[model samples]
Target: MREDTTVSALDSLYLANSIFEGKLLQAAAKYPFTVSNFFKSFDDEPLGITTSADGVLIIYWWDTLTGGTQHAYSCVAQYKTAHGIKSVSPASPNKYSCSYSKIYSLKSKDKIYYLAVYDEILSYHDRCQGIQIFLIDKDDLMPAKLIKTQTGLHSKIDYLYNDNSMRDQNWENELTYHEKTQTLTIPVALENGNLTDNYITYKFNGEYFIKLKSK
Candidate 1:
């Protein structure tokens, strides 16, 4: 039993390595992909990077298996002195059947806030359900302290109703950021059948998110 457990652990590690390497290489090609353009190819977009004066922080989704349950999780990697990119922390502690898809940085004076977008597992791909907002110190990137959480946002495709008739039919409830205005737009579903009719905008006030009136 002991030997079997050890072998299983080794196998799990190997699987994680193989999965992450392929996904990382695939995602690395689109380095520094901005938040607005990311949701356009949301399924294919697996990695997000946030850079600071200190170093670069990367967050990518790597699938893993544990006890016969497969996990699509977000993993953290950072640039080292001469060692290149290395994993600095464990996978995000998301509940089973949930995974983080992308990370966005909101610079507020001396602070940088990381907004991690995550979704419930209805399929193998990333279809946003909500967001987890957090931040990390520029000097130390291990612990990503969560500041806020917002739910009930849907980026799922309406396969039954959507057949490409409407513009952005696939991404009805998408999240986007306007760098010029420093505004983060979150699409929230107002009515059951009304896909993308309502939205909420927010701006980082150097400490927390301040809701802005709809314009």
Candidate 2:
């Protein structure tokens, strides 16, 4: 690309970063978010920073004591130059606890970013089920659009959660993600077991992650 084109793209990225940072900082002040305060309230610590495909950063921490309810990210929203954290989340109850939660960035197309926030809890036996997948548009970084704030996968157009046989039963006992194909593969049990040798690949389809195929 030409120097001017490169510089213009950089400028656009910088502006987006600035807008997102300011929005988060204002939210922090209004929400009164702080590392000390978060640790005090929930006893959660910093989980580290993750950047999206659009240079948007989000800091995730584990959730605990949800009691079979939805949880939210303990602390989040950040920038390279400064960190903007909100102590609270508008997520479903107990959705983001530390016991069984995983957050990571998926593949990016253009300036858009896709984030996977997996929330799971064991309702009955030692087996953990009820896995929830969330996607985010990191560029916006707004409460209304930070996370899709919905249930199940394949949010729009198609529904992957219902397409699979594990709908009524549960997601699985465990989940695995492959970075090469940008697919989250979860093992589905064959008979009366937690997981079988066979697996299912959940791939992102721009809007939501869907069941690309099974093996």
Candidate 3:
């Protein structure tokens, strides 16, 4: 690449970073984000954004230090910065760490639901996965409320399995949140070392997501 072209690209990236940082900082003021348990030295720009039907905006982001990366979800709607934070995840030599995947959201009748799927990596094949469901009240735009958490969830997309592992289910499948039906569906492993042909579906009752028949 030419020198000017490279410089222009770098400039664009910097500009984008600046804009995102300013927006996030402004949003954090009124609705303070819950800091990670493992303190971070710096964080990255918002990875993505998901908005509810009612116009509530939630951002997915992560921060890191020498130890590990911690991800968070934040709302942006006339907020002040709750605290000051750095803006980069320093390079680390270690491989084993805990991190979250891209956040997902589902809009129900009057509320928006968020999902955080996390993995704790101990080694190449030794890891534990979990899921946390959150509900944000659109009326107030307050911090998300934790509704439920489930551990030991398997991930075909993020995991590497042996060649002899069951292949009946589509390993490329991911969780699907249907807006029209207000349903969430994903494949589940059976006790017999096989995956269900039909993906299991869940619906939000008054309190939490309840398992419904597979679609």
Candidate 4:
């Protein structure tokens, strides 16, 4: 595992060629798989990787910083069997101008994955935080839905804003969906171990979002 001090430590990490190239090359040689170059341009943080149901690997390039109201681009290679390169495609092109920092390929009945993004604001003497999420189908790579809202301030001060207002703020958030119970859970925890949980049950007809609260 390689580490760098570029963006925040929360900035994702990518596997290096020297680390996984041997195993990947061995997999390609033994199995009927292809290898292609995956490329993208950004602040050079870590890259995300996940496998499809058919054993195809999907790589995601995540940008740590919110690009000043600009959208970041990602490119992925979908390999074909017989160990040959086939095609390259865009993950999210011209969708929205936000930061998708975390990507997860879900193993659920609905066959979908999720990307979590957020807008961060740091005070001179306080903590920084933000929020954004996306749900897309695994097969088509089409965005099923998106949530671009802020949470709340993360500082030492006890200042209060419009609690009922629906504007974006900065806070910690997580997204996950359960296949068996068809439930999505977003549990928020603070520094004191106080926890709040929010749940959403899905029928898989379409995409949906659930609010998370931190105690």
Q: Write the per-residue lDDT of candidate 4 for residues 1-215, one digit (tens) a residue.
A: 78764775323322333234344434533444333333333226355544344444443334434333342333343444343433334333233422234333444455444433322222222222222222332333344443312453211111111222222535433444455543344444344433334322222333333333333
Candidate 3, residue 163: the lDDT equals 23
Ranking by TM-score: 1, 2, 3, 4
Better of 1 and 2 by lDDT: 1
lDDT of 2 by residue, 64-116 (tens): 22234333224444432234333223243233232224334554564334343
Residue lDDT tens for model 1, 162-195:
2122355544546665655766676654333233
Q: What overall lDDT, based on C-alpha atoms, would model 2 receive against the true structure?
A: 0.41
**What tens digits encode model 3's per-residue C-alpha lDDT throughout 91-185?**
12123333555346665567556554445544333343444454433333232433332542222222222223344545554456565565666
Give the Cα error of residue 32 in candidate 3, in Å.
13
Question: Where in model 3 is the C-alpha error above 4 Å?
Answer: 1-27, 30-55, 63-110, 115-122, 126-131, 137-171, 190-198, 205-208
Query: Least accurate stretch of 10 residues (summed lDDT) in model 4?
Result: 153-162
Task: For residue 156, give model 2's deviation from the true position in Å.
Answer: 11
What is the lDDT for 193 in model 2? 41
Best by TM-score: 1
The number of clashing residue pairs in model 4 is 7
Residue 29's lDDT in candidate 1: 35
The 10 consecutive residues of candidate 2 with the worst lDDT sum are 154-163
Model 3 CA lDDT for position 32: 37
What residue runs in model 4 are displaced by over 4 Å at the alpha carbon? 1-45, 62-66, 69-71, 77-86, 91-94, 97-173, 186-196, 205-215
**Residue 124: error of model 3 in Å?**
2.1
